[model samples]
Target chain A: EAGVAQSPRYKIIEKRQSVAFWCNPISGHATLYWYQQILGQGPKLLIQFQNNGVVDDSQLPKDRFSAERLKGVDSTLKIQPAKLEDSAVYLCASSSTGGGGETQYFGPGTRLLVL
Target chain B: AQSVSQHNHHVILSEAASLELGCNYSYGGTVNLFWYVQYPGQHLQLLLKYFSGDPLVKGIKGFEAEFIKSKFSFNLRKPSVQWSDTAEYFCAVNAFRGNTPLVFGKGTRLSVIA
Candidate 1:
């Protein structure tokens, strides 16, 4: 089975500019996640979706970040008025289900550099 | 808030050397643990996971982790290292309570010399 797929492996933008990243998860997967990975740090969950419904997004910077899953298939993460601190890798991952003990597979991630 | 701690920031070892990386979490309640590895130019993938049952769990690439409930630790290990084992390893934890996102620690970068 194909793994998770992400677009624009790298991106650059100025502070206050807007940026968006796309993700297409493995077929039949029910859980999709967006994470931010700062240099030297592990990926941190920004949002999670289960079949088009948000499962968790407590850590998401609501004032600047937003994400959506379309028809429970594809997902997009957007950051408006991006800040320099937002310069980091954005990774997408998916699992067969949101149930217990399910393993998640990840994508190559989009590395964003905000000036 | 739940948090994870990876004691080692970087580790260097020669091939055939024993390996051990420490991981600890803050939450005391029921929790799930995982170890993920990211090779250069690759995505983060599961190395192993601990849900319940046996505290010792074996994962891909000859990696294993032992969960110590009393210590709130889940440490990764390998009997022997290889050049192929060079990667960034991350330890993550998720609480069993309400919808909680998995929290990860600053990763440990492992470099293995052949």
Candidate 2:
């Protein structure tokens, strides 16, 4: 089966600029997630969607970050007025269900460099 | 909030050496443990997971992990290391209830020399 897909493997923008990353989960996966992985750190959850509704997003920096999975298959993460701290690899993952033990398949990720 | 800790930031080993990476999580309730590996220029991939039934779970590529509930630890192990095993390994945890997202550790970078 094909894996999850992400666009524009890399991006560079100045601080305060706006940027967006896109993700397309594997066919039939019901759960999708977005994570931010900074240099030397592990992936941190930004948001999670079960179908079109959000399941968790407590860690998201709502002041500048937003994500939507409107048709239940694809997702977009936006960082408005980006900051230097926002420079990280944005990863997307999906699983067949919302179960905690379910295996999540990840995309190659979008590497963003906010200057 | 749940949190994960990986003891080693980096490790260097020779081929055919043994490997063990320590990971611990802080959470009072039941949880599901996972170890994900990212090779150079590759996306994160599951090395193994532990839910229940067994404390020791074997995964792909001769990797395995032992989940010790008493210690809140799930350490990854490989009996014999290879250069191909060099990568970044992350430990993550999520509530067993299935509503929470995985909390990840800082990750450990392993370098295996031939």
Candidate 3:
């Protein structure tokens, strides 16, 4: 079985530019999540989707960040008009279910640098 | 709000030395604790986890953590560490029973010198 997959292991964008990251969860997984990990900090949850429907996005910055899981399998996270503070590692993770002790499998993550 | 805290930002030790890393969480409700290790150039992998039952949980690579409910602490430990054990260790917590986001610590970088 393949693990969660993400594209563009690294990205560099100028300030005010736009960037997008993609993720594909493991087969049969129902929960997908997007997290932002700033340097010297832990991963912070940005959004979560359960079968194409959002379960939580309270921490997401609506003005510049957006994410969608259209088919409930693959997901896309976008940042429009990026800012210098947006530089961080975008990590995508997925779990097989919504139960206790559910281990989340993470992708390699896409490191972004905004100049 | 739930949050995780790892006090040790970095630690160094010689080969065969014992290791202990401190971790704590804010919420008092039901929780599932986990420790993840990220080797150089590698993605994060589960070191171990604690849900219910035995507070002392053992994980792969000879790592172990003890969950103290009263103290609200879960600390990672290893005996006779090797240089291979050098990596960034993260402590995370899922406060709710299901489908809840994990709150992670800043992580502790362990440097085991041979």
Candidate 4:
């Protein structure tokens, strides 16, 4: 089985510009997630979706960031008016279930560089 | 809020040397622990995980981690390090609350020189 897939492995945008990242999770996976990983730091959860319903997005920046997992198979994370601080790798991961011990699979990630 | 912490930012050792990377988490309730490794130019992959039962959990590539509930720690170790073991290691925690996302630590970069 193929792993999670993401588009545009790298991206560059100017401050205040808008950027979006796409993710296609593994087949039959029921949960999808978007995470922001700053350089030298761990991946931070931005949003999580179980199927088409959002499970958690408390840490998401409502003012500038948004994500959607329509149809429950693919997801897109968008950042408007991107700031220099938003220049980080945007990762997409998927899991089979929301169980405590379930392992998550990650994509290659889109590395964004905001100038 | 739950958070994970990795004590070492970077580690270096010669091939065949022993390796140990410390990971600590702050959570009062029952939780699951995992160790992930990201090789150069590769995506993150699970090395091992601990949910219950044995404190010592073995994973792929001869990697193992010991989960200490009282200490709130899950430390990764390898008896003998290989050059291929050079990668970034991340520790994550997931609480029993089914829908919660896994909280990850900053990560540790390990370099094994031949």
- Stretches of model 1 off by over 4 angstroms after superposition: B97-99
Over A54-111, each residue of candidate 4 has an lDDT whose tens digit, in order, gives: 9899999999999988898999999998999999999999999877799999999999
> How many collisions between residues are there in candidate 3?
0
Once superposed on the true structure, which residue ranges of model 2 sit more than 4 Å away at CA? none
User: Per-residue lDDT for B35-61 in model 4, tens only?
Assistant: 999999999999999988999999999
Would you estimate the TM-scores of all the predictions?
0.96, 0.98, 0.98, 0.98
Q: Model 1 over residues B1-114: C-alpha lDDT tens digits?
A: 889999999999999999999999998689989999999888898899999899999999899999999999999999999999999999998875444567899999999998
Q: What is the C-alpha lDDT profile of model 1 across A69-108, one tens digit per residue? A: 9799999999998999999999998888776566778999
TM-score of 1: 0.96
Q: Chain B vs. true chain B: TM-score for each candidate?
A: 0.96, 0.98, 0.97, 0.98
Better of 1 and 4 by DockQ: 4
lDDT of 3 by residue, B64-112 (tens): 9999988889999998899999999999999658688888999999999
Alpha carbon lDDT at A91, candidate 1? 95
All candidates: DockQ = 0.63, 0.87, 0.71, 0.84
Q: What residue pairs clash in candidate 3, if any at all?
A: none
Q: How high is the lDDT of residue B45 in model 1?
A: 89
Each candidate's fnat, listed in order, reads 0.61, 0.88, 0.55, 0.82
- C-alpha lDDT score of every prediction, in listed order: 0.92, 0.95, 0.93, 0.94
Predictions ranked by DockQ, top down? 2, 4, 3, 1
lDDT of 3 at B87: 93
In model 4, the clashing pairs are none
Single out the weakest 10-residue window by summed lDDT for candidate 4 chain A: A95-104
